[model samples]
Target: MVTLRSHTREKARRSTWAFLPPEIRRMILEEISRQRRWSCASTVCKEWHAIVATKNLNRLELNGASAEGLSKIILQRHLVRQIYLNIELPAYTCPQCRGFASSSEHGKLAKDALRKLSKALAAWEPTHHITLELNAYSPNDTDHCFKNHLYGFKHENDGDLLEKQEAWDDQRHGWVKGKQVRLPTTGAIQQLFSTVISGVQGERPQKVPAVKGVVIRRQMRRKIDRLALPKLLKQFPNLESINYEPWRVLFHQPDLLDSSCERCDQMLQDGLPKWPKHVRSVTIFEDFNEQIMEAIRSGIDPTISSTSMQIENGRRTRYGLGEAFAVKSRHLEHLSVSFMIDARDFFTSCKTLSDWPRLRSLVLTTPLMTKGPQHRMSDFLVKAGQVAQKMQRLKSLVIWHCSHDEASAVIFLKNKRSRRNVHGSATLTWRGTRDFDFSEEVVETWQQVVCTCNSHRGYVGQCDSHQLLCRIERVEGEIISHGDAIHHLRLPDGVIDPTSLRQIRQEGILQREARAVEAEPVDGSGEDP
Candidate 1:
């Protein structure tokens, strides 16, 4: 009983309360949470260990030394909640710091250990949310200098061991091939080669539990192979979004499907599967091949033809959409497309806006210059005016990264023409550099036209009765400029217009007052601006 009491006293001493107040302790814990490294907190005293474990702070990056360490943390439910596993391959470290050289036994052991860690994480559950970043290059393989050092044991017919070693070197062309000749048929070299080939082929579907999304950086070279893409897609049934780099879609001339439309039709029928109807959204970077394009064009459903399409600098082909391509998607609420398309082609593609009855918003981000100057500002404006007349349900129009001054001019002209018609009123939002201030010039020109029309004997602001025609507002950041005369404009209700002159003098007065107040130096300071 006395001995038990003594042991209990020692335990109590070890569990003594931390010195800092509760508030200070909380502040420290929060600070620790913000740190990138969790090992520092883990190394602290027993109380700190408990606190860190309880707080569950730190995004667990399972790579290098920490890969094996993850097994322990994952078992602790509280710690697992704090961690977001980032599974990356091991980096190659030199023998000096890594305490393992390629030639040494310890080096081999370390490599095996890291490989085991990778295998373990690959088998972990709830894999979907884990950010599995597969890098093509390992960190330690930095300069390609280490390739010279890897060695493999060899055998020779020569009686001398040194002679055998020399023979092996000659066969390998200097650097050792890390394989043992005496090993059984199913040796490490065969296994390694097979593993590498399988990895490249992506034949092994990584069991990612509950994966909501996946990002593949490298182009799946074998995607066209048997059951690759279909199998991969099956893994992510609940995938909401997939963001791929532009290079994934390789644009190759459709050699198999000649230039003939019938040939294109046959190839698509023979090669590609029907579209996955469940996939609501798909973003492709490369210009679609003729076969794919034909499949899209000739698809049975009108809705499929009307589905929102985005292209980048693709050559003009008679996509079977005919008039349907020009029609807005009744189902497609958002659409973004960019490329060098002819004005006539654009209008031809999307001529009937009435078909897209539910098309509420549209985004057109195309390069400004396309071919010659014949299809200039005036031509585009005339065509846009015709199209805008049909968008009866459009509520917002956003144009981003435009190249030519003509595009904005066309939009303004279209808006002006539409406003004159019975059904043309929508908020136009333009985001681009003010390289061409044609909107201001257009507004001024329109104002002059309105002024001249109203100047006639009986007309009293009758011709300038429209709200959009009367107000021309240009907003850049916080500052807004209207017609050439008004440097700034302020609205009475704090809502400025993009197309009229409304109380311009009040904006001037506000600016002048602000400048005057700013000019008066504060206290003993020098003159202010």
Candidate 2:
């Protein structure tokens, strides 16, 4: 116990980090490197720096880097697996009396960098996944509408939105009421993709071949440019799938939608390659229109497995949802349909869909239910049940009442897919209601008295004990208030937000006493209060 020299030596050994196994140390360093935090971690030692230097790099931002920069970074690195760019291409730029020219000098430089990348990749790995976040560029920045809170400019989520036109659509030509429709500028990305094809020339291939998947993010909220995607597919011969994602899920002004163009028609037709066979998993109204009521009847592949159709402030029948899913009925898998109209229009439009042989899941969000002979919950349930039975492989179905209508109830019913196989039975997960605890006795009695009542009779709600009743009182009890006050969460002023939440015990007594002043008459006893 009195051996100081031995104790000091033991303490020194424990302080050394070398005791960690080589594999374990490498793993920790690799993970940190993937997060692009290698520099911070490498300060510990030379060995860590050496190990971390070779880990897969996070996506390199192409727009921020030049060709030479990319080449140097990717020079000896075997782990550069992905890259992303919010590119504003040269061709899409306005050259003369231009509207939007926020110049991206690297339009051609970007292609060159990709070529260098393609060559580097062909030697080592086959390809890297590319995420192209596409947005229309605007050169003119002096327009105050683009900056400040003017013309809904502050409505955009981009922090630098005050300076840039990446979110340019909000600055419409006719900014108010969308009088003048602003067509999407497709030339820039079109030119970029056109130049990035594989092996067009000698040692230097014109197209960048380093690609496995292309994630296309449409920064502008407009009817999808069907022509733009087909051209992209041709640019990368080896691209397994061309996918689409909105940079932001925007709620578009219904009046501002432009599905066709008088000027871009010839341009759209001029450069489309033969449509290749690929799954059309794009959203309905957001991605396609016109002949695309089936959504791009001629341009995109007919086969589809998953799709989302959200018709805000509109109906599906007008949107021509006819033959949209039906054409690819057998191949359908996942579906999401939300609209403002009654559920009947949606189902009626999709009534042609008697079979969804491979359908796996469905989500239907609406304010109104189907109108049938009796038009009760039973009709809705029966229709839904019938739809469910057709989907032999269906896993989950969600029915949500978005509660956007006046006095409308809110409900979120998620069904357990496994229970569908049971004879005439389905399992639904019911979220809590304000009346849930109070309604138990009523539900139990109703179920016991008429035990013969089944799901088919629309007794599903009471049986499951989750029938929403919030609307019963709201019809006349409601009065309009400030939007923020009603929509946002509120806390009493004197209540400390970050304070200890153990138990206030004394909070709300004052409010209760005030409420008691106007409370119901009560007997002098505890009975019949």
Whose lDDT is greatest here? Answer: 2
Candidate 1 lDDT over 455-503, as tens digits, reads 3464433242442332224434332211212122111110112211222
Q: Single out the weakest 10-residue window by summed lDDT for candidate 1.
A: 520-529
In order of appearance, the predictions have TM-scores of 0.37, 0.46
Model 2: per-residue lDDT, tens digit, 327-413? Answer: 343454554433312343344555556666665555443334211122344355445555455555655554433221121222322
Backbone clash numbers for all candidates listed: 13, 8
Q: In TM-score terms, which candidate is top?
A: 2
Q: What is the lDDT of residue 92 in candidate 1?
A: 39
Indicate the worst ten consecutive residues by lDDT in candidate 2.
Answer: 499-508
lDDT against true structure, model 2: 0.34
